[model samples]
Target: LAALLAPGNFIVMGAALLLNGFAVAPTLTAGLAAAERSVVEKRKTEVLAWAISALNLGGALPPAITGYIIDTQGVSVAFVIPLVCMSLSVVMILPYLNIWREKVREIPA
Candidate 1:
């Protein structure tokens, strides 16, 4: 998706924006739900607090970084920031995947 953006392609940019919207819309809710599920009952509030803080920070910080990247590099290169961040986020959570799986599986239907 990042690779699809070019300097003057409105169609590609619009498509990317639409797809990006779809991708990001569920992130906060899903992230908080997963965070809540992954923690123990006693620590759930603390974990959720941290998750909220992280979400706030993540929401606030990226535009400035992306703007800087856009100024120095170009819009095409700036698009890669989200992709890189998403990849790194996945890597960061990989160690906890088993815990998350077990916790989620324990929830009754």
Candidate 2:
């Protein structure tokens, strides 16, 4: 944030964070919704527990891996790794978005 507050960088960083939040919110929400929807009625609690565990694991794994990479390879390369990972996630999720939209449409009138 201090780095972001530096003159011209502030505007750019703010815009990036804004865009990131917009993109992340729906993706994260959909992931949670999908997890909920996928559960059997009787086992919803167990499924939710697994879903939360998976979410935490996903959140933790990248940072740990990235931190290790940064320690060994330097900060710049570590930063690029997330860009690549995010790009891949977007590519993979794009198809699923259409599927999700169809499911939404199919909900009873």
Candidate 3:
């Protein structure tokens, strides 16, 4: 948010994006690992394929949508799409968050 809202500071935005880039790999890996671990061995391959498909679709769609929003409503409104998504994801995940936390705790890190 700070990066997005930073007043004419491209450097801050770049740095923020760079930091965010660092998180993407670990987050995706953990998500896929958890997804695989949650299912039976026979179903693991199917689950992984589905996960990859979703990730691919997710990666593909957002930029075009965001670009359209920016073209139509301008830069200010473009942020709303992600903010709403982030908020909605939080709301949807809150109930299951404790369960995930416990699962993470069980991992032999």
Which candidate has the top score in lDDT?
3
lDDT of 2 by residue, 57-99 (tens): 9898998999899999997686578669879989988988887
The lDDT ranking, best first, is: 3, 1, 2
Q: After superposition, which runs of candidate 1 have C-alpha atoms over 4 Å from their true positions? A: 2-7, 40-43, 74-76
TM-score for each predicted model, relative to the true structure: 0.71, 0.64, 0.80
Q: After superposition, which runs of candidate 3 have C-alpha atoms over 4 Å from their true positions?
A: 95-109
Q: Between prediction 2 and prediction 3, which has the larger TM-score?
A: 3
Q: What is the C-alpha lDDT profile of model 3 across 6-34, one tens digit per residue?
A: 96798988888899999999999989999
Clashing pairs in 3: none
Give the CA lDDT, 0 to 100, for residue 78 in model 1.
76
The candidate maximizing TM-score is 3
lDDT of 1: 0.82
- Count of residue pairs whose backbone atoms collide, per candidate: 0, 0, 0
Angstrom error at residue 64, model 1 = 1.6
Task: Give candidates' CA RMSD values in order.
Answer: 2.8, 4.3, 2.6
